[model samples]
Target: MAKDNDPRLLRGAAVRQRILDEAAQYIASQSSIGKLVSISIGEVAEVAVYVRNQARVAHQLKLPFDQEFWGSDVTQEECKARLQEMNDDPSILGVILQRPVPDHINLRSLQSAIHPLKDVEGMNPASIGNIIYNDVALAPCTAAAAVELIRETGLNMEGLEVVMVGHSEIVGKPVAMMLMAEGATVTVCHHMTRSVAMHSRRADVVVVAVGKAHLLGPDMIKPGAVVIDIGINQTPDGILGDVDTEAVKEVAGWITPVPGGVGPVTVAILMRNATIAHQRQIASGWLT
Candidate 1:
């Protein structure tokens, strides 16, 4: 375990607080803002914890929040229809669709159904595409959170070498794109990569989101490299991140611990996105 006062360990409390503070200021300036609606397809113990955290942060920001639970048997068409109604409802600020939805439901299609402006999660195809144009104000929560932490390091983004492990749309892919938008030279590694370590070893910063506990170790990184472990895997011992925190921290210049690192900031990013969605809604004249 990393020592409590270890300077190398990057905890999310400060970053999360900074982001929420900015969000709170923005939200306070708004005259009328709608509630953030989180929709869950079915009861999942794990997802409930995430929803609770998000709700807690929403309350802290003083943003109206609502939760909806739909039956698991609902059809994909019905899900899309309900989302469309939310898009038209001025009282609804943004919509968050929880993951691991029923096997029969089309997740991507449902994401596309959410309007880009209200797609606070940035999972919508249109929202992801907007990153290519250098518009990252509204981006995937985890991806955006990762970028925010990297910035917290105070390193110059332009031309910084970054290696991203994993290629999932919600995290890896968007992160690479978001970094590039920040002027960082990014290389993304996946299962087919000849050797992930070879790339990570040379990177100034390495962001891992492969969802495998302890996949990265001391040997895989260069001395003093910034390590951002985005994975959250369950184990008998407890929750663990992709990087071996205890061992990697010895060699790493900085590393984010699993549960206290990216997870909290992710919830804060969601609230920030809500504020951005509110701004765009007014810009589009959808809300007065």
Candidate 2:
């Protein structure tokens, strides 16, 4: 493992702090910002942890925060109705719908129910689609986090060679689109791709978001390449990222560690998104 102070490791702590500081300043300048409401459908431990992190950050940023834990049996209609209510409530600045809702809930429908101006998490289909037109101010949290880290590398984005090793809607797809919006050429590789490594080895930057642990290794990339590992897999050894960090570190110029890499930046993006949502709300006449 590289030393904690290793320059090769692209730890998210600094990037997270930069964003949080900006968010705090922005929130303080606002006349009357509304609370960010987090909605969790079931009693999942992971969801609990995520909510806690978000709430803690909200408190630090001095942004009002609220959360609701619905019973596992909450119906799809009930979820939509509550989101509709949040949409109408001016006190609610934004809404974050936690994932892995009860099987009975239509997650997509609930996402759509959140008004676009209040969709701080940017999970709504309309929100994600905005990336295609290059309006990334409200991109999904994780996808935006990946793009933020790449920017931290201080590399010029225009025409940068980027290979994205996943195609999932939430993370992979949006990240690719976001990168392309910045003028980087992005090739998305999925299970159907015959040679993911073949595409990655030649790229200036490689982003891996497939859920598989250690799916990317040193041999798959060229020396001095930037590797953004967006996967978080729980293994008997511990939580691991899609890229084999230690091994890949030897070859890649910069690599993001699993737990500390993209995770913190993701949470920070939520707060930043709230501020963006606030600005858009004022512009759209949703708030004064």
lDDT of 2: 0.93
Clashing pairs in 1: none
Error of 2 at 116 (Å): 0.9
How much lDDT does candidate 1 score? 0.93
| lDDT for each residue of candidate 2 in 1-288, tens digit (9 for 90 to 100) | 668999999999999999999999999998878999999998999999999999999999999999999999888988888889999999999999998898888889899899888999888899988989899878899999999999999999999999999999999999999999999999999999999989999999999999999999999998999999999999998999999999999999999998899999999999999999999999998888
Best lDDT among the predictions, by candidate number: 2
Deviation in angstroms for 154 in model 1? 0.4
Q: What's the TM-score of every candidate structure?
A: 0.98, 0.99
Give model 1's TM-score versus the native structure: 0.98
| RMSD (Cα, Å) of model 2 | 0.7
RMSD per candidate (Å) reads 0.8, 0.7
